[model samples]
Target: EVTVKGRFLNQRVAPCQLEVRGAAAVWGDDGRLTQWLSTQHAQGTVAPIAAANGVAETQVHILTPDVGGGFGAKIGAYPEELLLGVIAKKVGRAVKWRETRSESMVALGHGRAQLQYITLGGTKAGKVTHYQLWAIQDSGGFADMGTILAPFMTRPMSSGVYAIPNIECRTTSVVTNTTPVVAYRGAGRPEATAAIERAMDLFAFEIGMDPAEVRRINLIPKFLEPHTTVVGQTYDVGDYETALDKALQVAGYTELRAEQAKRRARGDAKQLGIGVSVYVEITGGVGNGESAKVEVLDDGRAVVYTGTSPHGQGHDTAWSMLVQEQTGIPMDKIELVWGDTDLVPIGTGTMGSRSLQQGGNAVFAVAGELVNKAKSVAARILEVSEADVVLDKDRGAFHVVGTPAVTKTWADLAIAEKSTGGLNHNDVINVSGATFPFGAHVAVVEVDTETGKVRHIAHTACDDAGKVLNPLLLEGQIHGGVAQGAAQALLEEVMYDADANPITSNLADYGFISAAELPSVTVVHMETPTPVNLLGAKGIGESGTIGSTPALQSAVVDAVSHLGVRNIEMPCTAERVWQAIQAAR
Candidate 1:
């Protein structure tokens, strides 16, 4: 039946599959334990490992050094991490676990294994009125935090970017004879966006309407402040339509339609298809706060300590920039310290895209406090009242108001302060709520009708994750996330046989996409600025993965829709596409 209602991981992230990092643990003789780990969360890892090993919390010292490609998999203590501590205790020696690239395929956690059932009701004019989603999440042999949290997270995102008047969602986390599923890229949010977005496309197809038009008709109107969806997530400021408009403009959607028309008119062997997706995802969703400490050194340089951990998010460089912006310190002269429990005992660690908005904001806040503290010192040194002291930020010095030439440099104050208790400030930034970073994506793909092979052609995205702190880091996050999303849509999947034997458990056997497979993504930036925090920032960590999957998958199916094909399962491989085409015929 038809209706007129409508509607879509890696470091360096190169084409080749990269190796997962290793972990080593050592229990010392002083009843004090030390661990050398490569992880996204040092404090996040220590507590669990300590509990599992029957050690006191104070006895554990966790150190993280130069981790690579954590994404979401390295946030917590895995079974392998516990194994090291156990072995080290019995053998009286340090134990380490280095997973080979092939071993990681089976030993490491897998993500996004869900059986979803979605139904949507909408008007012929493209206004979505009601929606429903149900899913069976495969928790695999061991149920971890990711499995426990997936269903809860999925419910709040049921409404996605639309203002559907009525909505219902349900999910069951079940144990299966497969590798345990954990957070990867967008985690449960991606699954939510995927289902709703797919439902919208299906509704559009049934109603014979444009997918983009259907989305626009149902989008939640622009909001300058907090707007709560029916599903219970309160989004910060956003203009979803503007993001969509920008993506359409950059993608040249009208021209793409003309090309598709010609291809269909001629019944060409290769066909053009375009897919559109508009999305909103929650970031800093779990722990909405992070801690920071800033100290002004005698040399006029700054040292920053942060609770949030980083694998590839570049907290060092990003936090330095935050300090530089707030204080007169040069970005190069600022030093960042993180992920070591011995040095930083209290931390929330990194997960759920909470780092920059929480951790980075703390850096900015503490630096500003340090500047205020320095003002009194400047007044004393310059033989003036506190009211007379003013910062000359351009010259990185403090002087009396309207007296730029009579200035005392930060180095001078820092040196003087060394004898009078060096200036230091610490703070924790707590946002009122989790921010909803929204955006739109357009994917264009070419299909070879004769072979059912899909070729990625052009892609454009408008990601609005409130106030980008570092444009380069933001782009890198998007680029990396897009690659992982495209992989799941077009190729990668963890498989198991009837006997619970792992299949496609190695990079060679599993289909991982490469640079040769992906097109250069054209991204447009939109900054709506969240009011929840000082930086006016939200999380960009998972936006690309949340938006790219459906866009690419929908494009593949649209390419062959003229031939009666309506849907194709994910990992839309040549075999699956061929089978769908044959059955449709």
Candidate 2:
């Protein structure tokens, strides 16, 4: 068994710790290295194997059998793994190379290297007057993917869910000797949310206004139609204020604040800080559609081939739900297959949360077509008019009106049609369109004035990614997003020395937040169904990241507003918070 594990350190800088302790043997067949890999892009890994073996790219076929999890870190092929194939070929023996967790941290790519200078100008009455964010991103050595990741994440959602018309955001990526930055959970959007949310709290403190009240005044009011931002993308639909109010109500913001005041009066060690952030994230932003092929077999079983790849996003469950809803196919009878390039050659893969909106929609459309085709075949078989026949979904078969006894099961219909032609239709059906998902978040945090230690106390989020297909899967997505966002706010940071040497090189050194550090995230589900897609679903994968980061940061600063503190940089670590408090004092 080849066990490969590596921790990606802050993007490009990966000091790997690998151990190959098994006997190296050779199959002695075709002299090809056949090893299982968990990679996002398979073709990208084949090149090094071919080059190292002194053979053509065709000689090396990198097959991704099963991937545990890859938050854009598994996109490209690594050099060390490629060397295994070469070593196997040179020695005419089988060699195994597996990475350790320590090695994975330094080797895997990190995300969000944005240094932001935010200046918020609002009124004493809690009206947002002006907002400006100037960011300098550390691209981390080679400008891998972070170059584009930073700007797309920082500039697009600069204004967030607010109606701050005088918003100005300028960002530039600077190369540092560290890990090559790539897309993490929320990628660059989380960085933007973090900066602006923290800035909102600073403005609220400067004006001596409640953080919630300040957000209410500035939030973009509920809009029936799409609204364009200063950054140029148009939001399909959102009730920003309603989301905020719902989240606040669910979280008991007023009570939390009352408790915070009590803790401060008694000089309690465990202080309470309430944070609120309003965010609008762009999901399915790539504008590319997903491909799905739904086929009904002779045995009444249905097979669904989807272009949207899923690691643990429950694509099997969610896509099967879509198929069952559209066609009368039962969940058990349907099998969902994906992630194989040969099977799904033409695919955009899964990134930027495009799976459900684009891919799921495709599945729905295909299932509809399959139902129509089945109905036509049933119409021919029963010698009844096509319009007169209707599908009895409860029975999973087509029945004639006023003649329920004369019904044909999908399996019988498929078998009856085999003598005439095939089960599938001749024409190819495809749906090409993209949808947008948006939401708001409220985060509560406590800050120690002396130590500057920021602790997350409570978090509430209201995200509207249109109609939810499955609430269970949706909640999981939100939970994962909240964890990543909270990590960005209170604990996680990819730091480097002055000469570009990475300081946080491993998971032990890097502050990856855990359940012990985070609060029980409160999710207030809101639906502002968009007309853009048939399923009325938008991407919910990144909403938590976009909304939670800002809220948490805002809360941290809001907790210490009475001390005359204006700003605190991301991670809001003990030292940074302490220094900010000292400077204010």
Candidate 3:
């Protein structure tokens, strides 16, 4: 048996590791190198291969097959995965190399193991006066994205939805012996929200004020146009109070407290808790705009090529909806393709929740151009001026005024144009600008005073990603994001030993939350269309994650507040909770 020892950081304040070994063949080959990758950013992987084998990036063509899941860990190529190409070329055979779940935990990058100290000064009425946050980000050895990610995330969203005038936030990324940290779901935004929300709850506890009341006093007033935060981000548009009130009403906060009071009165084993978080995250900030190509084939079908790569975010269905809305193409007749460098050429692979707002809007823009181009072509064939040609979207045809009989279908126009100018007039159309999405989340948890165990009872989130192109797809994104956020709050953690050795290196020790541990998530949708893009859509991918983490953590602490426990660090495990309760007693 080939033995491997892996270490990882645990959710608790300790380091742990696991060992596993098996008889296996682990090498790279041409077939596996070309087949298994699921990302469009191939430069990182191709560079090392070209150096090892004396070939150019053009020689190494990466094709993404069905990607199971990439949470942000799969954005670039890994060293072991790239070795397949070198080994395959050297042996003149296709090679295969797949890591077990054990290897994946330590080798793959982890996220958000920061030690934060936050202080907030606010009025007795709960309006925030001044806020300060100091973050010691545990970067886990190498500074892979996390170093830059932490500062950028905290700077933009340190104040969340609050209208705080004085905000002081500083972060220092430190190196530790562990897996390198990288972007995961909301990236650094979740950590930022978590810190500030926790601070708000702490301030509420100190001043004997309600957490919700404190939030209300500090939240920015309802506004259109831009509202700049103490940090540098200018919120394009939001109604922070509306989202908070809606979430509170839907959650039935007062009723929940009454139930909690009853449980406390009876000294019941099951305790009740409530937590709330409001956040505004920056999406489509990975530069601005995205590339999209829409083509009307001779058969009258529409083909869309988007620069956004989707692992399971349902880009296919969502982009198809955009094409249908603009070009009157039936959903089944539209084919959406992505993640291939040759087909897409240039693309910022999906991360930072930018796909729908940036990439989807680009698709909408290209589809609109296709409609106008077809109208112009139809006008030429019907012997009418371009202004006289009108597209009947209901009929999916172009008809001249006062001439219903003289109509040309999209298919007819494309076929007829082959003789006049060729397959397509323009190869591609690019769209500009990015959109911001915001949300609020409420979490309820039960804490066992004796055992220090925290259980998530309920979670409700309200997210607005501008105009949702597809409700089904948007809800799925929120579900995944909330689960990840809860996991970070109550279970997931990356740890290191005194000698900088990693522990909790695999799934068994890593504390990744599963369905068995999670409660059914409640999602509320709000639409406040963004004026920045043509589709008026913002990104929904990371909003749930950014808004959920702190809510859950605060709820756990709130559950035992009567016992004199003021602050509790994240991942409130049974042991940590028990210790906090013991110290309080």
Error of 1 at 320 (Å): 1.0
- All candidates: CA RMSD in angstroms? 2.9, 6.8, 6.4
lDDT of 3 by residue, 161-236 (tens): 8898988888888887777777777777777777778778877887788889888889989877888887778888
The lDDT of each candidate is 0.82, 0.71, 0.75
Best by TM-score: 1
> Model 2: how far is 185 from its true place, Å?
1.6
Q: How do all models score by TM-score? A: 0.95, 0.87, 0.91
CA-RMSD of model 3: 6.4
Clashes of each: 3, 24, 15
Return whichever of 1 and 2 wins on TM-score.
1
Ranking by lDDT: 1, 3, 2
Q: List runs of model 3 lying over 4 Å from the truth.
A: 1-36, 40-54, 419-433
TM-score of 2: 0.87
lDDT of 2 by residue, 1-585 (tens): 111111111222221212211112233366455544666544445566567667765555445554667666666656676666657666766676666675566667766666677777766787776777777777766877778765776688788778887878787888866777777666777667666666666666666678778778888888878888776767778788887788888988888888889987987765676777777777776546667787778998888887766767898999888878866779999998775555554455667788788888878887888789888889998999998889888888998898889899889888977886646532223334445566667777777776778778778888888988899899998998898777777777666678766677667787777789988877888888877777878888778877787677667766776667655666678897888778888
